[model samples]
Target: MTTMTFTRKDPPQWLLDFWKEIDDKTFGKGFDCFAHDAVCNLGVADWHGRDAIRENLRQFIDRGFTAHHDVVEYWDGGSLKVFHGKVRMTFDDPALPVVRPAMAHFFYMDEKDPAKVRRWLGSVGPIEF
Candidate 1:
Protein backbone atom coordinates (compact mmCIF):
# COMPACT_ATOMS: atom_id res chain seq x y z
CA MET A 1 0.00 0.00 0.00
CA THR A 2 1.16 3.50 -0.75
CA THR A 3 0.84 6.38 1.67
CA MET A 4 -0.35 9.74 0.49
CA THR A 5 1.77 12.65 1.59
CA PHE A 6 0.03 15.94 2.18
CA THR A 7 1.82 19.24 2.75
CA ARG A 8 0.61 22.33 4.57
CA LYS A 9 0.17 25.63 2.75
CA ASP A 10 -1.90 28.79 2.66
CA PRO A 11 -5.60 27.97 2.84
CA PRO A 12 -7.52 31.22 2.49
CA GLN A 13 -7.56 31.62 -1.26
CA TRP A 14 -7.83 27.92 -1.93
CA LEU A 15 -10.67 27.45 0.51
CA LEU A 16 -12.44 30.45 -0.93
CA ASP A 17 -12.13 28.93 -4.34
CA PHE A 18 -13.56 25.67 -3.08
CA TRP A 19 -16.50 27.52 -1.56
CA LYS A 20 -16.97 29.28 -4.86
CA GLU A 21 -17.23 25.93 -6.58
CA ILE A 22 -19.83 24.80 -4.08
CA ASP A 23 -21.72 28.01 -4.66
CA ASP A 24 -21.62 27.48 -8.36
CA LYS A 25 -22.96 23.99 -8.05
CA THR A 26 -25.68 25.06 -5.63
CA PHE A 27 -26.81 28.43 -6.94
CA GLY A 28 -24.42 29.62 -9.64
CA LYS A 29 -25.17 26.27 -11.39
CA GLY A 30 -22.07 24.16 -12.01
CA PHE A 31 -20.47 20.85 -11.25
CA ASP A 32 -19.58 19.25 -7.92
CA CYS A 33 -15.89 18.76 -7.18
CA PHE A 34 -15.79 17.37 -3.67
CA ALA A 35 -14.23 14.01 -2.91
CA HIS A 36 -16.23 10.79 -2.55
CA ASP A 37 -16.16 10.81 1.25
CA ALA A 38 -16.82 14.46 1.79
CA VAL A 39 -19.42 15.25 4.45
CA CYS A 40 -21.89 18.12 4.44
CA ASN A 41 -24.53 19.57 6.73
CA LEU A 42 -27.37 21.59 5.30
CA GLY A 43 -29.63 22.80 8.11
CA VAL A 44 -32.37 20.17 7.99
CA ALA A 45 -30.16 17.28 6.93
CA ASP A 46 -26.72 15.72 7.12
CA TRP A 47 -24.91 13.99 4.28
CA HIS A 48 -21.84 11.82 4.01
CA GLY A 49 -19.73 11.30 0.88
CA ARG A 50 -19.98 12.90 -2.51
CA ASP A 51 -23.01 10.98 -3.75
CA ALA A 52 -25.10 11.79 -0.71
CA ILE A 53 -23.96 15.38 -0.73
CA ARG A 54 -24.79 15.64 -4.41
CA GLU A 55 -28.22 14.20 -3.82
CA ASN A 56 -28.85 16.67 -1.04
CA LEU A 57 -28.01 19.62 -3.24
CA ARG A 58 -29.84 18.10 -6.13
CA GLN A 59 -32.98 17.93 -4.06
CA PHE A 60 -32.74 21.66 -3.34
CA ILE A 61 -32.12 22.46 -6.96
CA ASP A 62 -34.94 20.23 -8.09
CA ARG A 63 -37.24 22.20 -5.83
CA GLY A 64 -35.95 25.45 -7.32
CA PHE A 65 -33.96 26.57 -4.33
CA THR A 66 -31.30 29.22 -4.80
CA ALA A 67 -28.85 30.33 -2.17
CA HIS A 68 -26.35 33.08 -1.56
CA HIS A 69 -23.69 33.02 1.12
CA ASP A 70 -22.58 36.02 3.10
CA VAL A 71 -19.17 35.41 4.56
CA VAL A 72 -18.84 36.99 7.98
CA GLU A 73 -15.36 35.89 9.07
CA TYR A 74 -12.44 33.93 7.69
CA TRP A 75 -9.24 32.57 9.19
CA ASP A 76 -6.41 30.62 7.60
CA GLY A 77 -3.91 28.99 9.93
CA GLY A 78 -1.67 27.22 7.42
CA SER A 79 -3.15 23.72 7.15
CA LEU A 80 -6.56 24.64 8.50
CA LYS A 81 -8.99 27.22 7.23
CA VAL A 82 -12.24 28.26 8.84
CA PHE A 83 -15.07 30.33 7.42
CA HIS A 84 -18.02 31.71 9.33
CA GLY A 85 -20.95 32.70 7.17
CA LYS A 86 -24.67 32.77 6.63
CA VAL A 87 -26.70 31.74 3.63
CA ARG A 88 -29.98 32.98 2.24
CA MET A 89 -31.90 30.18 0.56
CA THR A 90 -35.02 30.78 -1.43
CA PHE A 91 -37.30 28.05 -2.68
CA ASP A 92 -40.56 27.84 -4.54
CA ASP A 93 -42.39 26.57 -1.48
CA PRO A 94 -45.07 29.18 -0.90
CA ALA A 95 -45.59 28.48 2.77
CA LEU A 96 -41.91 28.49 3.66
CA PRO A 97 -40.15 29.84 0.66
CA VAL A 98 -37.10 31.27 2.34
CA VAL A 99 -34.55 30.09 4.82
CA ARG A 100 -32.58 32.85 6.41
CA PRO A 101 -30.02 33.05 9.15
CA ALA A 102 -28.43 29.87 7.85
CA MET A 103 -25.05 29.63 9.49
CA ALA A 104 -22.11 27.59 8.23
CA HIS A 105 -18.65 26.71 9.48
CA PHE A 106 -16.35 25.24 6.86
CA PHE A 107 -13.18 23.52 7.97
CA TYR A 108 -10.48 22.76 5.45
CA MET A 109 -7.34 20.72 5.82
CA ASP A 110 -4.25 20.00 3.63
CA GLU A 111 -4.45 23.28 1.85
CA LYS A 112 -1.53 22.60 -0.44
CA ASP A 113 -3.68 20.31 -2.55
CA PRO A 114 -7.28 20.46 -1.41
CA ALA A 115 -8.53 17.48 -3.37
CA LYS A 116 -10.03 16.09 -0.16
CA VAL A 117 -11.66 18.10 2.58
CA ARG A 118 -10.77 16.45 5.86
CA ARG A 119 -13.95 17.73 7.48
CA TRP A 120 -16.81 20.18 6.98
CA LEU A 121 -19.28 21.33 9.64
CA GLY A 122 -22.27 23.61 9.25
CA SER A 123 -25.46 24.67 11.06
CA VAL A 124 -28.46 26.97 10.71
CA GLY A 125 -30.41 28.82 13.37
CA PRO A 126 -32.35 31.97 14.10
CA ILE A 127 -30.38 35.16 13.90
CA GLU A 128 -31.18 38.84 14.22
CA PHE A 129 -33.45 39.54 11.32
Candidate 2:
Protein backbone atom coordinates (compact mmCIF):
# COMPACT_ATOMS: atom_id res chain seq x y z
CA MET A 1 0.00 0.00 0.00
CA THR A 2 1.16 3.53 -0.69
CA THR A 3 1.81 5.82 2.26
CA MET A 4 -0.48 8.84 2.50
CA THR A 5 0.98 12.24 3.21
CA PHE A 6 -1.03 15.02 4.80
CA THR A 7 -0.16 18.68 4.67
CA ARG A 8 -1.98 19.99 7.74
CA LYS A 9 -2.88 18.13 10.96
CA ASP A 10 -2.37 14.41 11.18
CA PRO A 11 -5.45 12.20 11.18
CA PRO A 12 -6.27 9.58 13.77
CA GLN A 13 -4.93 6.05 13.39
CA TRP A 14 -8.37 4.62 12.79
CA LEU A 15 -9.00 7.05 9.95
CA LEU A 16 -5.69 6.15 8.40
CA ASP A 17 -6.46 2.46 8.66
CA PHE A 18 -9.88 3.03 7.15
CA TRP A 19 -8.38 4.74 4.12
CA LYS A 20 -5.77 2.02 3.84
CA GLU A 21 -8.47 -0.56 3.56
CA ILE A 22 -10.08 1.38 0.74
CA ASP A 23 -6.80 1.86 -1.09
CA ASP A 24 -6.08 -1.82 -0.66
CA LYS A 25 -9.48 -2.62 -2.17
CA THR A 26 -10.64 -4.37 0.97
CA PHE A 27 -14.22 -3.11 1.30
CA GLY A 28 -15.04 -5.61 4.04
CA LYS A 29 -12.39 -4.14 6.29
CA GLY A 30 -13.10 -0.56 5.32
CA PHE A 31 -16.85 -0.88 5.88
CA ASP A 32 -16.13 -1.90 9.46
CA CYS A 33 -15.11 1.69 10.16
CA PHE A 34 -18.70 2.82 9.87
CA ALA A 35 -21.57 2.18 12.25
CA HIS A 36 -24.33 -0.16 11.15
CA ASP A 37 -26.73 2.77 10.95
CA ALA A 38 -24.29 5.05 9.24
CA VAL A 39 -25.28 7.20 6.29
CA CYS A 40 -23.08 7.97 3.30
CA ASN A 41 -23.48 10.66 0.69
CA LEU A 42 -21.41 10.02 -2.38
CA GLY A 43 -22.29 13.24 -4.27
CA VAL A 44 -24.19 11.25 -6.84
CA ALA A 45 -26.48 9.52 -4.38
CA ASP A 46 -27.16 9.00 -0.72
CA TRP A 47 -26.86 5.58 0.82
CA HIS A 48 -28.18 4.57 4.22
CA GLY A 49 -26.64 1.97 6.48
CA ARG A 50 -23.22 0.41 6.35
CA ASP A 51 -24.38 -2.38 4.05
CA ALA A 52 -25.67 0.03 1.44
CA ILE A 53 -22.61 2.23 1.67
CA ARG A 54 -20.35 -0.79 1.27
CA GLU A 55 -22.20 -1.89 -1.83
CA ASN A 56 -21.93 1.52 -3.43
CA LEU A 57 -18.26 1.85 -2.63
CA ARG A 58 -17.61 -1.67 -3.80
CA GLN A 59 -19.05 -0.89 -7.20
CA PHE A 60 -16.65 1.99 -7.75
CA ILE A 61 -13.67 0.17 -6.29
CA ASP A 62 -14.29 -2.75 -8.61
CA ARG A 63 -14.69 -0.61 -11.71
CA GLY A 64 -11.16 -1.11 -12.96
CA PHE A 65 -10.04 2.01 -11.14
CA THR A 66 -7.06 2.25 -8.81
CA ALA A 67 -6.62 5.33 -6.69
CA HIS A 68 -4.03 7.00 -4.50
CA HIS A 69 -5.23 9.66 -2.08
CA ASP A 70 -3.04 12.56 -1.04
CA VAL A 71 -4.55 14.23 1.96
CA VAL A 72 -4.08 17.99 1.91
CA GLU A 73 -5.84 18.91 5.12
CA TYR A 74 -7.47 17.30 8.14
CA TRP A 75 -9.43 18.51 11.13
CA ASP A 76 -10.64 16.87 14.31
CA GLY A 77 -13.35 18.48 16.41
CA GLY A 78 -14.58 16.08 19.07
CA SER A 79 -17.59 14.53 17.38
CA LEU A 80 -16.65 15.57 13.86
CA LYS A 81 -13.73 14.99 11.56
CA VAL A 82 -13.07 16.53 8.17
CA PHE A 83 -10.50 15.75 5.54
CA HIS A 84 -9.72 17.17 2.10
CA GLY A 85 -7.58 15.36 -0.39
CA LYS A 86 -6.69 14.85 -4.02
CA VAL A 87 -7.09 11.43 -5.48
CA ARG A 88 -5.06 10.18 -8.41
CA MET A 89 -7.13 7.67 -10.32
CA THR A 90 -5.76 5.35 -12.94
CA PHE A 91 -8.03 3.44 -15.22
CA ASP A 92 -7.43 0.19 -17.06
CA ASP A 93 -8.55 1.72 -20.35
CA PRO A 94 -5.63 3.12 -22.28
CA ALA A 95 -7.97 5.49 -24.11
CA LEU A 96 -8.59 7.40 -20.89
CA PRO A 97 -6.09 9.77 -19.39
CA VAL A 98 -3.82 8.13 -16.85
CA VAL A 99 -3.97 11.05 -14.43
CA ARG A 100 -6.96 13.18 -13.55
CA PRO A 101 -6.88 15.67 -10.73
CA ALA A 102 -9.88 14.97 -8.53
CA MET A 103 -10.55 16.46 -5.15
CA ALA A 104 -12.41 14.71 -2.36
CA HIS A 105 -13.98 15.96 0.83
CA PHE A 106 -14.87 13.69 3.72
CA PHE A 107 -16.90 14.77 6.71
CA TYR A 108 -17.26 12.13 9.36
CA MET A 109 -19.84 12.22 12.15
CA ASP A 110 -18.88 10.45 15.36
CA GLU A 111 -21.28 11.76 17.96
CA LYS A 112 -22.33 8.72 19.97
CA ASP A 113 -19.33 6.56 19.26
CA PRO A 114 -15.93 8.05 18.64
CA ALA A 115 -14.61 4.78 17.27
CA LYS A 116 -17.08 4.48 14.43
CA VAL A 117 -18.45 6.96 11.94
CA ARG A 118 -22.18 7.61 12.29
CA ARG A 119 -22.37 9.49 8.98
CA TRP A 120 -20.02 10.13 6.12
CA LEU A 121 -20.66 13.00 3.75
CA GLY A 122 -18.25 12.67 0.88
CA SER A 123 -17.88 14.27 -2.53
CA VAL A 124 -15.49 14.06 -5.42
CA GLY A 125 -15.43 16.99 -7.78
CA PRO A 126 -14.25 17.99 -11.26
CA ILE A 127 -15.12 14.63 -12.69
CA GLU A 128 -14.04 14.92 -16.32
CA PHE A 129 -15.55 11.69 -17.48
Candidate 3:
Protein backbone atom coordinates (compact mmCIF):
# COMPACT_ATOMS: atom_id res chain seq x y z
CA MET A 1 0.00 0.00 0.00
CA THR A 2 1.19 3.49 -0.86
CA THR A 3 1.64 5.93 1.98
CA MET A 4 -0.36 9.17 2.00
CA THR A 5 1.55 12.44 1.82
CA PHE A 6 0.35 15.46 3.79
CA THR A 7 1.22 18.77 2.18
CA ARG A 8 -0.02 21.10 4.90
CA LYS A 9 0.98 24.72 4.39
CA ASP A 10 2.00 26.09 7.78
CA PRO A 11 -1.21 25.22 9.66
CA PRO A 12 -1.22 25.86 13.41
CA GLN A 13 0.44 23.26 15.63
CA TRP A 14 -2.85 22.64 17.42
CA LEU A 15 -4.63 21.94 14.15
CA LEU A 16 -1.86 19.60 13.09
CA ASP A 17 -2.07 17.76 16.40
CA PHE A 18 -5.84 17.48 16.06
CA TRP A 19 -5.51 15.79 12.69
CA LYS A 20 -2.96 13.47 14.20
CA GLU A 21 -5.54 12.45 16.79
CA ILE A 22 -8.06 11.76 14.00
CA ASP A 23 -5.61 9.63 12.01
CA ASP A 24 -4.48 7.89 15.17
CA LYS A 25 -8.12 7.14 16.13
CA THR A 26 -7.82 9.05 19.40
CA PHE A 27 -11.20 10.80 19.48
CA GLY A 28 -11.05 11.29 23.24
CA LYS A 29 -8.01 13.52 22.91
CA GLY A 30 -9.25 15.25 19.79
CA PHE A 31 -12.47 16.26 21.56
CA ASP A 32 -10.44 19.04 23.16
CA CYS A 33 -10.34 20.88 19.84
CA PHE A 34 -13.98 21.86 20.03
CA ALA A 35 -15.54 24.43 22.32
CA HIS A 36 -18.31 23.40 24.72
CA ASP A 37 -20.94 25.00 22.52
CA ALA A 38 -19.37 24.33 19.19
CA VAL A 39 -21.47 23.43 16.18
CA CYS A 40 -20.67 21.06 13.37
CA ASN A 41 -22.52 21.11 10.05
CA LEU A 42 -21.86 18.16 7.81
CA GLY A 43 -24.27 19.32 5.05
CA VAL A 44 -26.83 16.63 5.69
CA ALA A 45 -26.96 17.03 9.47
CA ASP A 46 -26.11 19.63 12.05
CA TRP A 47 -24.48 18.49 15.27
CA HIS A 48 -24.76 21.12 17.96
CA GLY A 49 -22.73 21.45 21.13
CA ARG A 50 -19.52 19.69 22.08
CA ASP A 51 -21.08 16.58 23.55
CA ALA A 52 -23.30 16.03 20.53
CA ILE A 53 -20.46 16.60 18.12
CA ARG A 54 -18.25 14.28 20.11
CA GLU A 55 -20.89 11.58 20.03
CA ASN A 56 -21.31 12.01 16.28
CA LEU A 57 -17.58 11.71 15.73
CA ARG A 58 -17.38 8.74 18.04
CA GLN A 59 -20.06 6.94 16.08
CA PHE A 60 -18.22 7.57 12.86
CA ILE A 61 -14.93 6.39 14.32
CA ASP A 62 -16.40 3.37 16.01
CA ARG A 63 -17.92 2.23 12.70
CA GLY A 64 -16.02 -0.32 10.68
CA PHE A 65 -14.06 2.20 8.66
CA THR A 66 -10.51 3.48 9.11
CA ALA A 67 -9.77 6.90 7.67
CA HIS A 68 -6.55 8.62 6.72
CA HIS A 69 -6.56 12.28 5.70
CA ASP A 70 -3.88 13.76 3.47
CA VAL A 71 -3.94 17.51 3.78
CA VAL A 72 -3.12 19.13 0.47
CA GLU A 73 -3.44 22.79 1.38
CA TYR A 74 -4.42 25.17 4.15
CA TRP A 75 -5.66 28.75 4.24
CA ASP A 76 -5.44 30.83 7.38
CA GLY A 77 -7.83 33.78 7.54
CA GLY A 78 -7.37 34.95 11.08
CA SER A 79 -10.09 33.14 13.08
CA LEU A 80 -11.33 31.31 10.00
CA LYS A 81 -9.20 28.43 8.77
CA VAL A 82 -9.79 26.36 5.64
CA PHE A 83 -8.29 22.98 5.01
CA HIS A 84 -8.40 21.10 1.70
CA GLY A 85 -7.49 17.45 1.79
CA LYS A 86 -8.25 13.98 0.52
CA VAL A 87 -9.40 11.19 2.77
CA ARG A 88 -8.91 7.48 2.17
CA MET A 89 -11.46 5.34 3.94
CA THR A 90 -10.96 1.62 4.18
CA PHE A 91 -13.93 -0.42 5.28
CA ASP A 92 -13.79 -3.66 7.24
CA ASP A 93 -16.32 -5.23 4.88
CA PRO A 94 -14.35 -6.67 1.98
CA ALA A 95 -17.30 -6.23 -0.37
CA LEU A 96 -17.23 -2.47 0.05
CA PRO A 97 -14.81 -0.54 -2.12
CA VAL A 98 -12.27 1.83 -0.60
CA VAL A 99 -13.28 5.46 -0.99
CA ARG A 100 -10.92 8.34 -1.65
CA PRO A 101 -12.71 11.65 -1.68
CA ALA A 102 -11.64 15.27 -1.65
CA MET A 103 -12.59 16.94 1.59
CA ALA A 104 -12.74 20.51 2.82
CA HIS A 105 -13.02 21.79 6.38
CA PHE A 106 -14.01 25.35 7.26
CA PHE A 107 -13.28 26.03 10.91
CA TYR A 108 -14.29 29.14 12.76
CA MET A 109 -12.48 29.50 16.05
CA ASP A 110 -14.16 30.81 19.16
CA GLU A 111 -13.28 34.46 19.69
CA LYS A 112 -13.05 34.05 23.45
CA ASP A 113 -11.14 30.80 23.18
CA PRO A 114 -8.87 30.92 20.14
CA ALA A 115 -7.71 27.32 20.59
CA LYS A 116 -11.21 25.92 20.30
CA VAL A 117 -13.30 25.58 17.20
CA ARG A 118 -16.68 27.27 17.55
CA ARG A 119 -18.13 26.21 14.23
CA TRP A 120 -17.06 23.62 11.72
CA LEU A 121 -18.51 23.13 8.23
CA GLY A 122 -17.27 20.20 6.24
CA SER A 123 -17.81 18.78 2.72
CA VAL A 124 -16.50 15.61 1.11
CA GLY A 125 -16.81 14.32 -2.45
CA PRO A 126 -15.19 14.37 -5.87
CA ILE A 127 -14.33 17.81 -7.14
CA GLU A 128 -13.59 18.98 -10.61
CA PHE A 129 -9.94 19.75 -11.24
Candidate 4:
Protein backbone atom coordinates (compact mmCIF):
# COMPACT_ATOMS: atom_id res chain seq x y z
CA MET A 1 0.00 0.00 0.00
CA THR A 2 1.21 3.51 -0.81
CA THR A 3 1.17 6.17 1.84
CA MET A 4 -0.90 9.20 0.87
CA THR A 5 0.15 12.66 1.94
CA PHE A 6 -2.30 15.44 2.69
CA THR A 7 -1.52 19.16 2.38
CA ARG A 8 -3.82 20.47 5.07
CA LYS A 9 -5.26 19.76 8.47
CA ASP A 10 -5.40 16.16 9.61
CA PRO A 11 -8.66 14.37 9.21
CA PRO A 12 -10.20 12.33 12.01
CA GLN A 13 -8.78 8.90 12.64
CA TRP A 14 -11.84 7.12 11.31
CA LEU A 15 -11.74 9.10 8.11
CA LEU A 16 -8.06 8.44 7.71
CA ASP A 17 -8.61 4.75 8.32
CA PHE A 18 -11.39 4.79 5.80
CA TRP A 19 -9.13 6.15 3.10
CA LYS A 20 -6.34 3.89 4.18
CA GLU A 21 -8.53 0.90 3.54
CA ILE A 22 -8.85 1.92 -0.10
CA ASP A 23 -5.13 2.39 -0.54
CA ASP A 24 -4.69 -1.02 1.02
CA LYS A 25 -7.02 -2.45 -1.61
CA THR A 26 -9.57 -3.36 1.02
CA PHE A 27 -12.57 -1.34 -0.06
CA GLY A 28 -14.92 -3.60 1.86
CA LYS A 29 -13.32 -2.52 5.08
CA GLY A 30 -13.63 1.09 3.96
CA PHE A 31 -17.41 0.94 3.89
CA ASP A 32 -17.45 0.68 7.65
CA CYS A 33 -16.72 4.39 7.74
CA PHE A 34 -20.00 5.50 6.16
CA ALA A 35 -23.33 5.96 7.86
CA HIS A 36 -25.99 3.37 7.25
CA ASP A 37 -28.08 5.88 5.34
CA ALA A 38 -25.25 7.70 3.64
CA VAL A 39 -25.36 8.83 0.05
CA CYS A 40 -22.47 8.66 -2.40
CA ASN A 41 -22.39 10.51 -5.68
CA LEU A 42 -19.88 9.40 -8.24
CA GLY A 43 -19.54 11.45 -11.42
CA VAL A 44 -21.47 8.96 -13.50
CA ALA A 45 -23.62 7.28 -10.89
CA ASP A 46 -25.25 7.97 -7.57
CA TRP A 47 -25.50 5.30 -4.91
CA HIS A 48 -27.83 5.84 -2.01
CA GLY A 49 -27.67 4.13 1.37
CA ARG A 50 -24.74 2.17 2.60
CA ASP A 51 -25.89 -1.14 1.09
CA ALA A 52 -25.97 0.24 -2.45
CA ILE A 53 -22.82 2.22 -1.94
CA ARG A 54 -20.96 -0.74 -0.51
CA GLU A 55 -22.06 -3.05 -3.32
CA ASN A 56 -21.15 -0.60 -6.05
CA LEU A 57 -17.79 0.12 -4.50
CA ARG A 58 -17.27 -3.61 -4.21
CA GLN A 59 -17.70 -4.04 -7.94
CA PHE A 60 -14.77 -1.81 -8.81
CA ILE A 61 -12.65 -2.89 -5.90
CA ASP A 62 -13.28 -6.51 -6.74
CA ARG A 63 -12.11 -5.74 -10.27
CA GLY A 64 -8.72 -4.69 -8.89
CA PHE A 65 -9.01 -0.92 -9.11
CA THR A 66 -6.70 0.72 -6.68
CA ALA A 67 -8.00 4.07 -5.44
CA HIS A 68 -5.84 6.75 -3.96
CA HIS A 69 -6.71 10.29 -2.94
CA ASP A 70 -3.98 12.84 -2.42
CA VAL A 71 -5.38 15.82 -0.67
CA VAL A 72 -4.28 19.24 -1.88
CA GLU A 73 -6.66 21.25 0.29
CA TYR A 74 -9.28 20.64 2.94
CA TRP A 75 -11.78 22.88 4.69
CA ASP A 76 -13.38 21.75 7.92
CA GLY A 77 -15.70 24.58 8.84
CA GLY A 78 -17.10 22.88 11.91
CA SER A 79 -20.05 21.27 10.15
CA LEU A 80 -19.14 21.17 6.48
CA LYS A 81 -16.00 19.40 5.36
CA VAL A 82 -14.73 19.79 1.83
CA PHE A 83 -12.00 17.84 0.09
CA HIS A 84 -10.01 18.62 -3.02
CA GLY A 85 -7.25 16.36 -4.20
CA LYS A 86 -5.56 14.40 -6.90
CA VAL A 87 -6.91 10.90 -7.40
CA ARG A 88 -5.16 8.09 -9.17
CA MET A 89 -6.24 4.55 -9.79
CA THR A 90 -4.86 1.44 -11.36
CA PHE A 91 -7.50 -0.38 -13.36
CA ASP A 92 -6.43 -3.90 -14.11
CA ASP A 93 -9.36 -4.42 -16.44
CA PRO A 94 -8.91 -3.81 -20.16
CA ALA A 95 -12.26 -2.11 -20.58
CA LEU A 96 -11.62 0.73 -18.13
CA PRO A 97 -8.08 1.86 -18.70
CA VAL A 98 -6.13 3.26 -15.77
CA VAL A 99 -6.60 6.99 -15.23
CA ARG A 100 -5.10 9.86 -13.35
CA PRO A 101 -7.80 12.26 -12.38
CA ALA A 102 -7.00 15.97 -12.38
CA MET A 103 -8.37 16.27 -8.86
CA ALA A 104 -10.86 14.54 -6.62
CA HIS A 105 -13.34 17.05 -5.28
CA PHE A 106 -16.04 16.34 -2.72
CA PHE A 107 -18.24 18.06 -0.21
CA TYR A 108 -19.37 16.17 2.87
CA MET A 109 -22.23 18.45 3.79
CA ASP A 110 -24.16 16.66 6.47
CA GLU A 111 -22.72 16.76 9.94
CA LYS A 112 -25.68 15.64 11.95
CA ASP A 113 -23.61 12.66 12.88
CA PRO A 114 -19.98 13.58 13.26
CA ALA A 115 -18.65 10.06 13.18
CA LYS A 116 -20.32 9.02 9.94
CA VAL A 117 -20.26 10.64 6.53
CA ARG A 118 -23.92 11.22 5.65
CA ARG A 119 -23.91 12.90 2.30
CA TRP A 120 -21.05 12.92 -0.19
CA LEU A 121 -21.02 14.75 -3.49
CA GLY A 122 -17.92 14.67 -5.67
CA SER A 123 -16.49 14.19 -9.13
CA VAL A 124 -13.13 13.33 -10.58
CA GLY A 125 -11.91 14.39 -14.00
CA PRO A 126 -9.62 11.85 -15.56
CA ILE A 127 -6.82 11.91 -18.10
CA GLU A 128 -7.36 9.23 -20.70
CA PHE A 129 -4.71 6.61 -20.96
Best-fitting candidate, measured by lDDT?
3
For 1-129, candidate 2 gives per-residue lDDT tens digits of 844333456876777777777777876676677888888887877899988887887787789888777777787665667787777777888788767465565656667777898888777765666
What tens digits encode model 4's per-residue C-alpha lDDT throughout 1-129? 844343456665666676676677665666666788888887777889878886776675676678776767676655456677776787778698767676554545456767677877777775335
lDDT of 3 by residue, 1-129 (tens): 844344446777776776777677876666788899999997575999978987787687678888888878898776788998888888888898888898889999999998899999999874521
lDDT comparison, 1 vs 2, better candidate: 2
TM-score for all models, in order of appearance: 0.58, 0.82, 0.82, 0.72
What lDDT does model 3 reach?
A: 0.80
Question: Which regions of candidate 3 deviate over 4 angstroms?
Answer: 1-8, 126-129
Which 10 consecutive residues of model 4 have the lowest summed lDDT?
2-11
User: What's the ranking of the predictions by lDDT, best on top?
Assistant: 3, 2, 4, 1
Candidate 4 colliding pairs, count: 0
Whole-model Cα lDDT per candidate?
Answer: 0.58, 0.74, 0.80, 0.68
- Model 1 global lDDT (CA atoms, 0 to 1): 0.58
Between candidates 3 and 4, the lDDT winner: 3
Error of 1 at 48 (Å): 2.7
CA deviation > 4 Å runs, candidate 1:
1-33, 41-44, 93-99, 110-115, 126-129
Evaluate model 1: give its TM-score. Answer: 0.58
